[model samples]
Target: MARAPKDHKTNALRELDAAGIVHEALFFDADPAMTGVQIAQSQGEDVDAVFKTLVTEGKSGEHYVFLVPVACELDLKKASAAAGEKSVAMVRARDLLPLTGYVHGGCSPIGMKKRFATFVDETAQLFDEIYFSGGKVGCQVRMAPDDLALLVPFAYADLTA
Candidate 1:
């Protein structure tokens, strides 16, 4: 029932609201150098329940999104397999903001400039709720994975290395 502060509504939060997805918005003191693990630690959340959003490009030039546990790395082979691409590569950092309307550490799977094929690490299903970036640094959203599916269509897969 923790809602975002009215003064700090992010695109992701707004999208969730429009979709009627229940969520809690968590804010913390954050530094640009902070990693996703550090952010989750600051929130006192288990690393397994917190995910980081990653963007990749397929050989066909299509973009895809993947949500992996903050403590894990995305296995490119698995990612490519899930994406049905022969290969996939991380999108260049410089292109993130323009392409997804999000910066590297602040990307969320919820709201992007455009919708792409999105996948979540199957481990996310192990939690009743999961935490992910709320569209910007210092903001995170806690919600049921099923609720998240209402906002973004995604499949669960073994995405970790």
Candidate 2:
């Protein structure tokens, strides 16, 4: 028998379920040292279809979220523009858990301490489904961009460098 999603419950998964968003939860052996790209490679997932969730603090003191391919760099200028901020900076690692309710490597755009304006790289739309951390290290969630948008209300933008 297959394990149920509740067996691997995480804030991200719970939110998806509550929103009626269909998604697949994938669990893997998590090495603390592995980068997002390495995690994707370990699972035989395409680098471009595995996204990393990032949180940033804008000049106005507002927070925002961005999802980019695991192997790409977020273009800060583009990110600032997309978020309508004069500039944006990554939230300090020490503050991540408190601010987002997730650790650095486990952050997911789906369920945050509070919803911030979220954006996904435009390239994500090219794939049928994209994967991201399922609110914890060693777990991932796969869903269509449209489903994600409906659940989280994100916009697609040129977010990667």
Q: Positional deviation of 54 in candidate 2, in angstroms?
A: 0.3
| Error of model 1, residue 94, in angstroms | 0.9
> Candidate 2, TM-score vs. the true structure?
0.94
Residue 100 lDDT, candidate 1, scale 0-100:
96
TM-scores of the models, in the order given: 0.95, 0.94
**Deviation of model 2 at 1, angstroms:** 16
Q: Candidate 1, residues 109-141: lDDT per residue as tens digits?
A: 988999999999999999999999999877899
Task: Give the root-mean-square deviation of each candidate in angstroms.
Answer: 2.0, 2.1
Error in Å for residue 36 of model 1: 1.2
Cα error, candidate 1, residue 32 (Å): 1.4
